[model samples]
Target: MSPLFPALAARSARPALRFGDQALSHAELATAAGALAARIAGAPRVAVWATPTLGTAVGVVAALLAGVPVVPVNPKTGERELTHIVTDSSPALVLAERGAELPPILAELARLDTDITGSTEVAEATDTVDRALPAEPSPESPALIVYTSGTTGPPKGVVLPRRAVAATLDALEDAWRWTEDDVLVHALPLFHVHGLILGILGPLRRGGSVRHLGRFSTDGVARELSSGATMLFGVPTMYHRIAEALADDPELAKALTGARLLVSGSAALPVHDHERIGAATGRRVIERYGMTETLMNTSVRADGEPRAGTVGVPLAGVGLRLVDEAGAEITAYDGDTVGEIQVRGPNLFTEYLNRPDATEAAFDDGWFRTGDMAIRDPDGYVRIVGRKATDLIKSGGYKIGAGEIENVLLEHPGVREAAVTGEPDEDLGERIVAWVVPVRADAPPSAEELAAHVAAQLASHKRPRTVRYLQALPRNDMGKIMKRALHD
Candidate 1:
């Protein structure tokens, strides 16, 4: 209901953000954003070179303040992906960090560079501070046109409105008991929902502060948590590293134990890593569930148990229900019954920018089809089994989830990382295939040993019929296992 950044206007020298060595107080951010917003006020849309820098944060805030739709382009994007997004979005202007070398891919669009230092610092004493900030934009007006990672096709632009972003942040505020006093820290990339919306805007809306690690490391996490940060946000890769370090690093354990909340998302936090972190720190890592199409639909509540392997109940104001394979709504929560997760609420994206067919297909009635399969427990906690497209394996007429089997394999001391998929088979409809990165590459665990370990923990049918070893599993920037890449 309130403006997304009510904290920026009235400031008293409180620190607002930190990235590597760069820092900005609330007053400084308002001044800088005000200046940038004024320069880009009339543009229909803008593209942000979403680097892990203060300029990126200032540029995004400025665009939002100016009521312009922002298309965040990842800096590490490939040639084809870069060309497609730049062509599709067709922004009136591009905002990037000053003096930073950009691929000639962006040579066409008009560009604006943010000056975060001597040449570009926004000062509270600026003449524009008293200038009337534009009237707040309508809630339904498009705020961001974030493009998906062209997994299925060329990336489709997801049109998220002001209402959706604001509502999701407010719901998280209630769920996490988030407030101005809480200072958050994370090292996630800024292009997506987890980092840009919740990691950045969520705290800004609550009038709190955030410190970005620029790049993630156990040492960086330890330093920030020990300094003043109250919360730490990371993906499973980050946590996996933390879990490994805690076995030898007392400082890392102490820092985690002293923090208020440690959260993981983007992919399922392996139950093994979850238990290890909890056992050492006496604090369980909270998990949440959502997608690019939806900002955040559910999270483990701060007051609730950090249930290992489960993303806790639906976020406030979200209507969540699972549907069976027959397309019937799953009403009662009988444990272990798998279904596709569907959600309806203000937190949903409005459309796939320009693609009416996709917009039409993404929704049934008002609910968005997440394509994610999960089982709901009696108390409303949702444990995601895996994605319907890749992580669900059908073997010998029985449906199987790769997540649980991968978790089982991870429990083995020899396995450092694991991913499971289904491949064509003659006798069985599809056979489970396990791809592993082993701790001991010279003497990797054998198929038989891994099979027996899985069978002891789960049904024998769920064991991988075939095993593959790799030096490392391919992962995206978000730490999600690129299951499709595993095939190649």
Candidate 2:
């Protein structure tokens, strides 16, 4: 396969990236990353303090150019997590923006301050730098070692191969109809796959530009989409904010209406938010399914229907199947029977770094076990309900999906945010519990009322047997509710 960034070396004067007030053209990025790549070349690996800044983008690109695997460290990570990452990855040096304050754990490592501003004297040397860079590494070589959120244990390093990145991006290009003329806009943090790999590298691989909002806000989203951004990428939290603000802000709705594509991922976007946004703006927010181990698997195609609850069909080259608890492949696409989603494709990561046992356990018959429970439509669209471990509730001998209940709960006017989980029950084996943040704390809806509301929408057995109201739901950086924290 060709190099991951062909357009970078093209030296086009077209704008390539924008973060807040800073902007870099394709030529500038190539020069800056190439220069940094020369300095960091031949390192075993490097850690990028992945802040949502121009420097982070350049640093990641530089590491890729030098054929060195890069590990993205979240800036908001606590001391213990940061220490474990540093100790596990054992990067030779840390790449961060100049003068940026780093934590003590990262500060202890050899640091290289990345310069986003390309040297003017290197204007003539852009081509020289490109030529001087190491030959494109083998497609199977490790490109990135991204750490998971470590929900179950200490974060495991997912080693992504160069081909996996290229394959996923190429597949998205086919699915989303993405191209060089498109300019993407988003405000996602750069530490994760959603923000760093897809939000940044996805555009670069297509030779398109991206404008980062630095932080998400209705004002920033409206400004960029209205000005010229063709596409927007965000998680459910950002989209929910847009849905809420559309009624009070006409400009926000109007800006969203003009966009070519609006994509949401990292978590399930509530059907309520989807309907609200579509009703106000005449544009539907597209949701895709992916994780740290798999860069991308399924996406609602740009040319296909933007189904409210479903994640559309698997992308080109991806093989998807549903399996039962006994590990039997569920062959029927009935749209009602739930099963664990298993996928096999080039988009899969090579392995878990230094965890051979864990890596081996993650796959079955060459398929990566996603641990996500979902139902597939006859038409092939996959509707994810929740994680197999947390979202699937067995009540009264009926298996229920928490995501469907959560979506229904969000439709209630009295509810602001909702998460559903199962707890041990003497009668039902596992009783459905609804954790809610109500619209009014003092005058919240009665548990009985909420339960009846759920029963009206879904089956009686799926209704929440117990309701726990809260001021707020605990969410991770990506806006996914930390379901395990609820029990704590």
The C-alpha lDDT values of all candidates are 0.89, 0.92
Q: Per-residue CA lDDT of candidate 1, range 1-488, in tens?
A: 45768878675367788888888887778888878888899899999999988899999998998999999989999989989888888899899998877778786778888757764436433756666556678998889999897789999999999999998988888888888889999999999999999898877878889999999999999999999889999999999999989989999999999999998999999989999999999999999998888889999999998899889999999999999787799887876777889999999998998899999999888899999988888998998989989988889978888888999999999999999999999999899999999999999999999999999998889999999999999998898899999997
TM-score of each: 0.97, 0.97
Provide the clash count, candidate 2: 0
In candidate 2, stretches whose alpha carbon ends up further than 4 angstroms from where it belongs are: 118-133
Please give, for residues 146-166, the per-residue lDDT of candidate 2 as tens digits: 999999999999999999999
State each candidate's clash count.
0, 0
Q: In candidate 2, residue 152 scores what lDDT? A: 92
lDDT of 2 at 195: 94
Question: Model 2 RMSD to the real structure?
Answer: 1.6
The TM-score between candidate 2 and the true structure equals 0.97
lDDT of 2 at 386: 95
With a 3 Å backbone cut-off (N, CA, C), the pairs that clash in candidate 2 are none
